[model samples]
Target chain A: MAQNQSAPDATRRSERSRRAIYDAALALVAEVGYPKTTIEGIASRAGVGKQTIYRWWSSKADVLLEAFLDLSGQAAEAAAQDRPSADASPYGIPDTGDLAADLKHVLRATVDELRDPAFEAPSRALAAEGVVNEELGRRFVATLLEPQLQLYVDRLRSAQEAGDVRPDLDPRIALELFVSPLAQRWLQYTGPITYEYTDTLVDYALNGLAPR
Target chain B: MAQNQSAPDATRRSERSRRAIYDAALALVAEVGYPKTTIEGIASRAGVGKQTIYRWWSSKADVLLEAFLDLSGQAAEAAAQDRPSADASPYGIPDTGDLAADLKHVLRATVDELRDPAFEAPSRALAAEGVVNEELGRRFVATLLEPQLQLYVDRLRSAQEAGDVRPDLDPRIALELFVSPLAQRWLQYTGPITYEYTDTLVDYALNGLAPR
Candidate 1:
C-alpha cells in the first residue's frame, strides 16, 4: 500500500510525521529536559515508529536541533507575515532605509516570540541545558542562535555601508549592544522585555550615550 | 569544652565550618546540578553537621547564593589588589576620573573571573538552572547579578555627574549594553570572552554604534 501510494500523498504524509516529531521533541524536552529526551520517547509521543525517527535523525540532539530550527522558522514566518514583500526570506531583517526602525521592528517581534508560551518553555529548557553543557551550548549557538545573530550582523553591515553605522567598529560586536541586552534580560530575568525597551535600545545604540 | 572555648576560638571554628559548607555546596551544585544537590550532601561533604548548615542557611539555594557571593568577593579582591588605596571597596569600580579606562579595568577583571575554573563550573550550573527556573532566576539576578550591576550603575551615575555620560540615560540599561554582551558570550558560548573583547564592548557602548 505504501509503495502504491502517489508521490504527493507520500510527501504529505512525510510532512505530517516531521511536524509531529518536532512537536513531540519540543514537548518532551520542555517536560523532561535535554539529557533525558530520547528518540524512542519522541517516536512514541509522535505516534511514529522508532525507525522513523532513526531514519531521519541519528541522535536526539539532531532531532531537537532540527525541531528548534523548524520552530524558529515558524516564529519568523509569523513575525514577518505583515511585511510588504511576502516573498522575501523570513530569516533576514527588512532593509527599510532606516536602521533604527528595522532593528526595533525585529526586536519587538523577538519580544513577542520570547513571550509566547509555546516557545518559552522548550526554549528555556534547551537554553538552560546549553548554559552548563559547553559542547551542546556551542552546537546550539552555532546552529540556532548564531544564524539569528548573523541577521543583526548583516543589518549592521548594511548600516555601515549606508553611513548609518560607524565604519570603524566591528559589526559583530556592534550588533551585540542591542541584541545581547535583550537576550540577557530574557535568559536571566535581569529585566523586562517590551517593545518600548527594545525601541529604547535602538535609540540608545544609534545615538551615543555621551550627549550627542 | 564547648563552653570553655574563648570568643575568638569559637569564631575561628565557626568561620572554618562556614567556609567548608560554602565550598561543599558550590562543589555539589557543580557536580550534580541544582535539583540533586541537597542540604545533607553539602553537610556531609563539608565534614560538618547538617544542623550546622541549618543553623546558618535554611536551604541549598541559600548556601549556593552565599557561596557565589563569597566567590565573587574573592574575585573582586584579587582583581583590585593592585590598586593604590588598599582600603578601597572591592565591590566598587575604580574611578580614575576617566570612565572608559575605569570600565575597561573592571570588565577586564571580570573577564579573568569568568574564566576562573573555581567560579566557572558552579556559576554555570546555577545559571543553567536559573534559566529554566524563573523563581530561582529572579532570585539569582536580584541577589547576585543586580548588586554587581549596581556597581556599574553607581559608576555610570558618577560619570553622568562628571559629564562623561549623558545624564538623561538610565544607568541600569546603559550598563547592560556592555555587561550583557560579555554575559551572553559567557553563558551561551556564542563568542569568545577576552580582555580585548570586553574592552571593545565598553568602547562600542559608550561611543554608540552610529557615527559621531
Candidate 2:
C-alpha cells in the first residue's frame, strides 16, 4: 500500500515539473528570443534544478520544439471543443468533401492562433531565429512546418482523386497557392489577415486568375 | 581649368567610396547579421571613417536599404543584358501581350536572382531579422518588398483590362497566390526552388485548380 501510494505521488511530481519546464521555456524564448534563452534560464524560471530539464531535453532547441508542439496540441484541443464533431487529430486537415471550404476553415483558425498573444510572441521569436540560423530553420521546417504542410498535401490528393483538383498538378505545389499567401501575410505583415482574406485566397486558388 | 579638373576627380573618388561602403555594409550584415552590424564596422571594413557613413545615411538600416536597392538595380541590368529587348526597369513586370508567358519569364529571372550567392546571404540575414523585429520587418516590407509586389499588381491590372483575368478578383491578393509561395520557399528552406517550380506556380495561379 505504501509503495503504490508513493508511486502515484512521484508521477504527479514529475508531471508538475514537466509542465513547469515547458511554460518556462516558452516564456523565456518569448522574452529574450532563442539566442539568449538558455537551459539554465528555463530551469531557474521553472524553479527546478538544471538536472530536471537535462533529464528531459538535450538542448534549448529541443525544449522549445517540444513546448511548441504541446502548445499547438492544446490549441487544437480548444478548437476541437468549439466543434465537437470536427476531427480532433492535430495531425490531419479535415476533408468534408469540400476542399476550398475545409482549407478556409483551418486557415481561419490559424489566423486566430497566430493573432493570439500567447502563441504569437514565442512563435515570432523562434521563427526569427530560424530565418538567420539555417540549421535551426531547416530543423523547424522538417519537424514542425512540414508535418502541417503534409496534411494539406493529403487533402489535395483526396481532391485530385475526386476530380476536384487537376490530375496533372502536384499536390505539394498546388497547396502552396493558397497556404503560402496566408503564411506570407502573417509572417511579414504584408497585409491584413481576416476570414474574408483567407476565404478569398481559397476562391482564387481554386479558380484560375484568368477567365474560366 | 584646375577647379573643373578637380571637380570631376572628386566626384569619381566619392562614387568609389560609396560603392565600397555599400559592399562593406552588405558583407558585414551577411557575416555578423543585423544586430551586430554597425556603422563603425561598415566604415572599418570599407577603409573609411565612420563620419563618412554617417554623412551619407542616418542609420545602418538606411545604408542597408540603399545597398539592396543598388544591388537589385545591378541585377536587373545584368538580366537585361541577357535579353536585350526586355524592359530593364525594375519598377514594373513586363506586360508582353501574353500574360502567362510574361509572368513565367519574370519568375524565372527571380529564381536566378534568389540563387545568386552574393545576393542570397545578405538578403537572408536582413530578411531573417525582419521576421522578429516588428518595426524593421514592417519597414523592410513597406520599402523593399511591397514595391516589387506592386509591379505584379500593375501587370495583373493590365491583364484584367485585356480580359485575360476576371474583373472581380482583387489583383493584389491574386498575385500572392504565385508570389508568396516562391517567397516562402526561399525564406524558410521549406522546398527546392527552380525555374520549373516557379513556372508551375504561374500555371497553377492563372488557371483554377478546378476543371473548367
Candidate 3:
C-alpha cells in the first residue's frame, strides 16, 4: 500500500519536472537561439539536475522538439476552447462542409498563433537555424512541420471527395497555395498577416486568378 | 596621352577588384554564415585592403547585398544566354499573352536559379540570418525579393488588362499563390523543388483548385 501510494506521487513529481524542463528549453532557445542553447543551460534554468534532463531526453534537439510539440498542442487546445462546437481534434483541420470557410477559419487561427509572443520567438529562432542547417531543417520539417501539413492533406482529400476540390490536384501542393503564403508572411515578414489577407488567399486559391 | 591611358587602366583595375570582392563576400558568407562574416574577412579573401571595401560600401550588409545583386545579375545573364530571344530583361517577366505559359516559363527559370550551387548556399545563409533578424529580413525582402515580386505584379496587371485574369483580384496576393509555395519549399526544405513542381504551382494558381 505504501509503495503504491508513493508511485502516484512520484508520477506527479515527474510530470511537473517535465513541464518545467520544456518551459526552460523553449525560453532558452528563444532567447539564445538553437546553436547557443544547451542542455545544461536548460537544466540550470529549470532547476533540475542535468542527469534528470538526460533521463528524459537524448539531446537538446529532442528536448526542443518535444517542447515545441507541447507548446503547439496547448495552443491548439486553447483555440478549440474558444470555439466549443468546432472539431476539437487537435490532429485535424475542421471540415465544416464549407471548404473555403473551413480553410479561412484554420488560417486565421494560425495567424493568431504566429502572432502570439510565446510561440513566435522560439519558432523564429528554430526556423532561422533550420534555414542554414540543412539536416536540422529537414528534421524540423519531418518532425514538426510535416505532421501539420498532413492535416491539410487530409482536409483537401475530404474536399476532393465532396467535389469541392478537383480530384486531379495533388493535395500536398494544393495546400501550399493557401498555406505557404501565410507561412512566408509570418516567417519572412514579407507582408502583413491578417484575417482579411488569409481569407483572400483561400478565395484566390479556390478560384483561379484567371477570369472564369 | 599618358594620363588618359592610365585613367582607363585604373577603371579596369577597379572593375576587377569589385568582382573579386563580390566573389569573396559570397564565399565567406556561404562558409561562415552572415553573423561571422566580416568586412575584413571579405577583403582578405578578395586580396584587397579592408579600407577598399569600406570606401565603396558602408557595412558588411551593404557589401553582401551588392554581392548578391551582382551574382543574381550574372545568373540572369547566363539564363538569358540560354534562350537567345527570350525576354532577357532582368526586370520584367515575359508577357506572352498566354498568362499560364508565361508564368510557367518564369517559374521554371526560377527553379533553375534556386537550384544553382553558386546561388543556393550564399542565398540560404543570408536568408537564414534574415529569419531571426527582423531589420535585415525586411531589408532583404525589400531590396532583393520585392523587386522580383513586382515583375509578377506587372505581368498579372497586363493579364488583367487583357482580361485573362480577373480585374478585381489583387495581383500582389495572387502572385503569392505561386511564388510563396516555391519560396517556402526552397527555404524550408518542405518538399522537392522541380520544374514540374513549379509548373504545377503556376497551373494551380492560374486555374482554380476547384473544378472549372
- Which number leads on TM-score? 3
Looking at model 1, the pairs that clash are: none
Chain A TM-score values, per prediction: 0.93, 0.96, 0.96
lDDT of 2 by residue, A49-140 (tens): 99999998899999999999899889978877775476636456778888888899889888899999999999988888887788998998
Residue A110 shift from truth in candidate 2, angstroms: 0.7
Model 2 vs. true fold: TM: 0.96
Candidates 1 and 3 compared by TM-score, better number: 3
Stretches of candidate 2 exceeding 4 Å from the true structure: A84-91, B86-91
Cα distance off (Å), candidate 1, residue A173: 0.7
Tens-place lDDT per residue, model 3, A1-212, is 99999999999999999999999999998898899999999999999999999998899989998999999889888987777475737557888899998899899999999999999999999999998899989988999899989999999999999999999999999999999999999888899999999999999999999888
- Model 3: C-alpha RMSD to truth? 1.4
True contacts kept of each: 0.87, 0.89, 0.89
> What is the per-residue lDDT of model 3 for residues B1-212, given as tens digits with 9 covering 90 to 100?
99989999999999999999999999999999998999999999999999999889999999999889888888777767766375636546776678888889889999989988999999999998898899999988998889889989989999999999999999999999999999999989999999899999999998989998
Clash number by candidate, in order:
0, 3, 0
| Candidate order (DockQ) | 3, 1, 2
- Cα deviation of B152 in candidate 3 (Å)? 0.2
Error of 2 at A1 (Å): 3.0
